[model samples]
Target: MERWKINLIVLWLGQFMVMSGMTMIIPFLPLYIQEMGIHDPHEVAVWAGLIFAANFVSSFIFQPIWGGLADRFGRKVMLLRSGFGMAFVMMFMGMAATPLHLLLLRLANGVISGFMPAAVALVSANTPRERMGFAMGTLQSGSVAGTILGPLFGGVLAEWVGFRPIFYITGGLLFAASVLAAFLVKEKFDIEQAKTRPKMSVFSGFRELIRIRQLPALYSVTFLIQFSILSSMPLIPLFVQELHGSGQLLAFYAGLVGSVTGFSNMIASPLLGRLGDRLGSQRILAIALIGTGLAFIPQAFVTNIWQLLASRFLLGVFMGGLLPSVQTLIRQYTPSGMESRAYSFNTSALALGNMLGPVIGGAVSGLIGIRGIFMTAAVLLLLNALWVRLSLFPRNQVQKTGS
Candidate 1:
C-alpha cells in the first residue's frame, strides 16, 4: 500500500476503536441502572434517557467550540484530548455507584467528545480533494462499524463480565486508542495559509456557520438522517424480546445484529463515498435517503428477530454512505479556512438529533408501540427524500470547494 493509504488505515482503525468503545455504553446502561437498585421501568427509562441525551447535549453545545479550536490550535490536539477525556470518563462511569454519577460523567464526556470530528478535519485537510470523499467515507465507516460492534460486544460483555467490566474494557480501549493516536497522528497545516488565515471571532464564525445559505438544508438532512436511524435503535432490544429470545441470548442477538450491520456498513461506505466523488454528493445523498426510506418501511413488519436484524443490515448498506457524503458536501459548501466551523455545525446537528431521537422514540414507542416507531421513522425518511428531491436536487448544487 502507498504511504497515504497506510495513514488512512491507521487513522481509520483508531477512529473505529474509539467509536466502538464509546458506543459500548449504550446497550447496557439501563441494565446497569437496574442492577444498582432502580427497578421502576419509568424511572429506569427516564434515567437512561437522561444519561443517553446528556452526552449529546454537552457535545452539541461544545462541538463548534472544539471545531474552531482545532482550526486555530491543531486537529491532533483535539483528537488526543477527546480520546483521553472519553477514556477517563468511561472508566469513571464504570466505577459509578449511582445513576446521577453516571449521568454526570456522560455529560462531561459529551462536552469533550471531539475525536471523530477532529479526525474528519484532519482527513479533510490532509487528503487530496479528489480523494477526500473516499477518505471521509472510510473514516465514517469506522464510526458506523464502531456503533455496530460496540453494542454487540457491550451486550455480551455486560452479560458475561457484568456491566462494570464492560465499562473498564471500553475505557481501556479508548485509552489505547489515545496512546496510538498520540504516537502516530501528525498535523500538517499549510504554514503560509495559516499565517494568512483571517482571525474571525468566535461569535462571527458561528454567525457565518448559521447564515450559510445552503447549510440549513444540509443540517436538516443530517438531523433527519440521524433521527431516522436512531428511531429504530432503542427499541431493537425490545424487538428481540418479542422474538422469544431469553435475556442472555438477546444480548448475543444484539451483538449479532450489530456485527452484521457493521459488516455491511464497512463494506459499502468507502465505495459509496468514492461514487459520490465521481457522481456528486447530492446524487449519493438522494439515493441513500431513498434507499434508507425503503429499507426502513419493511422493518415494521419483520416477523422474527432474524428478519428484523436482516432489515437493519440492509439499511446499513444504504445509510453507510450518507455521513461521508454529507461531510464532503459541507466541505464543498464552506471555504477552506472555515472548514472547522462547518464541521462543527454538522457535528452539532447530529448531536442534536442524538439527544432528541431517543426521547421521541421512547414517547412514541409508549404511545404507538415499536412497530409504529419504525413506520414513523420510515415516513419521516420518505418525507426527507421528497424534500431533498424537490428542493436540494434542483441546483445540482454540490458546490465546489471555496465556492
Candidate 2:
C-alpha cells in the first residue's frame, strides 16, 4: 500500500471527525448560551455571534505559529497536537456554567485549531505531485461530508440527549480520531537536519510569500469567495421564514438548505478535482467562479424553497470546485521546502473570511433586504472570475517553484 494512500484514508477520517466537532455546535450554541442563564433574545444573539467568531479570531492569530512549527518538526505532530488539544477543550466546554466560560473555551479551541489545515499540508506534502488535486479534493470531500452531517446529527442529538451531552459526545469523537491518527499516520522526518536549517519566522515567511505576484490574488480569492458564501448563512433562516411564514418545520427547512450544499459539495469535490487535474485548475477555477455567480442570481430571485434549494445545490458544486482549485494553485506556486508555511498562511486568509463573513452578512441584511446578500455575493464571484482570467490566463505564468 502506498504511504500517501494510507495518509489520505486516515486523514480523511480525522478530518471528518474534526469538521463534525467544529460545526456540530452551531445549531445549539445559542441554546447553550440561554441555558447558561442568558434570557434576553438580543443578548443571546450577540453572545452567539461572539462565541462563534471567537474560534476563528484566535485561529487567524495562531495559524502561522503552528505552520512554522510544522515546517521545522513535522506536520503530523501539529495535527495530533490540535486534535488532542481541541478534544480536551471541547470536553471542558461541557462543564461551563456561564457564557463567559463557554466563550473562553471556544477561544482556546481556536488557538489550538489547525487539525484540518495541518492535514491538508501533510497530504499535500506526501502525495504525488500530479495527484495533489485528487488528494485534496478527496480529502475535502470527507470534511464536507462531516460538515453536512454535523448540524443534522447535532440537531437530532440535541433533541434526544440535550446540549451538554452533545459536547462530550463530540469530544469523544475527536479524541478517538486523534488516537487513530497517532497509530495510522506516519511521516519521515530528520530532527537533527531540521534543527540545523535556518528557520524563517512566520511573519518573515508571510512577507516572502506576499512578494510572489500570484499569491496575494489567490489569497484574496480565498478571502472573497469565503466572504461571499458565508455572507448569506445568517440570513437563510430568516429568508425561509419570510417566504413561508412561521411554522413547526421552519427550522428544519432552513437546515435543509444548509445541509444540501454540503451534500452536493461532498459529492462533487473529488469528481471536479479529477477534472481540474486534467483540465488545469486555472480553467476549472474560472468556470467555477462564473457558475457560482450564475447560481446566486436565481437564489436572489427565488420565490419558493425548491428554487432556493436548486440554486444552493448548484452553488455547492461550483464551490466544491473553487476551493480545491485555489489549493492546487497554492501547491503549484509554493516555494520549495515551505509547503507547510504556505498552507498555514493561506489558512489564515480563510480564517479571516470565516470571522468577517457573518459580520458582512449581518450588516448587509440591515441595509438591504435578504435577497441583496445573494446578489452581492454573485457580483463578487463574477468579478473574481474576470480577475482570475485576466491575471493567470494572459501570462499562463504561475511563478514556478519545486514545491
Candidate 3:
C-alpha cells in the first residue's frame, strides 16, 4: 500500500482498539456505580447522565479549537496528541476513587478526544479527491466496530474481574494506540504559514460555519442522519431486558447487536463510498437515506432478539453510506484551506444530534414504548430522504461541473 493508505489503516486500527476500550464502559456503568454502594437508583441515574454527557460537553467545547490547531500544526501531530492525552485520561479514570473524579476524567477525555477528527483529517488531506469518500467510509467503519466490541468486552471484564479492571484494560489499549501513533505517523507542520497567517481565531472558525452556502442542507442531513441512526441507543438495554435475559446475557446481546451493526457498517461503508466515487456522493446519500428509512420499519415489528439484531444489521448496512457521503459533499462545497473548520461545523451538528437524539428517543419510547421510537425515526428518515433526493441529488450535474 502507499504511505497514506498505510497510515490510514494504522490510524483506523488504533481508533478501533481505543474506542473499543472506551465504549465498553457504558453498559457496565450502572453496575459499577451500584457496586460502589450508590444504592439509590435516582442518584445512580443522575450520575449516569452526567457521566455520559460530560465527555460530549467537553468534546463539543474543544473540537473546533483542536481542529484549528490541527490546521496550523499538522494532522499527524494532533493525532498523536489526542492519542496520548486520551491514554493519560483513561489511565487516570481507571484509578478514580469517586464518581466526581471519574466525571472529571471523562471531561478531560472529551477535551482531548479529537483522534477521530484527526484521523479523518489525515485521510482527507492525503487521499486523492476521487477516493476521499471511500477512504473516509472505510475509516468510519473501524470506529463503529469499536463501539460494538468495547461494551461487550468491558462487560465480560467487569464480570470476570470488576469495573476497575475494565478501565485498566481500556486504559492499556489507549496507551497502546498512543505508542503506535507516536511511531507510525508523521507530518510536516506549516511553520511558515503559522507565522504568516493572522493569529488563529475562533471567530474566524465560526465565520467559516456561516460562510458555506449549502451548509444548511448539509447540517439538515447531518441532524436527521444522526437522529435516525442513534434513536435505537437508549432502548437497547431495555430491549434486552424485555426479552427476559440475565444481566450477562443482556450485555452479550447488546454486544451482539452492536457488533452486528458495526461489523456490517465496516463491511458495507467502503462499498458505499466506492459507489459514491463511481456515481456521486449525492446519489449515494439519497439511496442510503431511502434504504435506512425503509430498514427501520421492520425494526418496529421484530418478534425476537434475532429479528431485532438482523434488523439493526440491515440498518447499519444502509446507514453506513451516510457519513462518508456527507463528509464528501461538505468537502466539495467548502473552499480550500477550510477543511478543519468545515469538519468542526459538521462535528457540531453531530454533537447537537447526539445531545438530542437519546432524550427524544427515550421520551417517545417511554410514552409509546420502543416501537414508537422506531416508527418515528423511520418517518423522519423517509422525509429526509425525499428532501435530499429532490433538492440535492437531482442537481448533481449542475454541482459536479461547477456551472
The C-alpha TM-scores of every prediction are 0.86, 0.94, 0.89
The numbered model that scores best in lDDT is: 2
Candidate 1 — worst ten consecutive residues by lDDT sum? 394-403
Each prediction's Cα lDDT score? 0.80, 0.86, 0.78
For model 1, state the Cα shift of residue 32 in Å.
3.3
Instruction: Summarize candidate 3's per-residue lDDT along 16-48 as a digit string, tens digits.
Output: 976786677887887777776787999999988
- The regions of model 1 sitting more than 4 angstroms off are 1-3, 34-42, 159-162, 191-198, 201-203, 237-260, 301-310, 366-368, 389-403
Model 1: pairs clashing at backbone N, Cα or C within 3 Å = 152-255
**After aligning candidate 3 to the native by TM-score, how far in Å is the CA of 379 from where it should be?**
2.3
Put down candidate 2 lDDT per residue, 120-230, tens digits, no spaces: 888887888788888889998988888888887888899999999988999998999899899989887666777787889888889988887777778878888778878
Best by TM-score: 2
- TM-score of model 2 relative to the true fold? 0.94
State the local distance difference test value for candidate 3. Answer: 0.78
lDDT at position 123, candidate 3: 76
After TM-score superposition, the amount by which residue 97's alpha carbon in candidate 1 deviates from its true location, in angstroms, is 3.3
TM-score of 3: 0.89
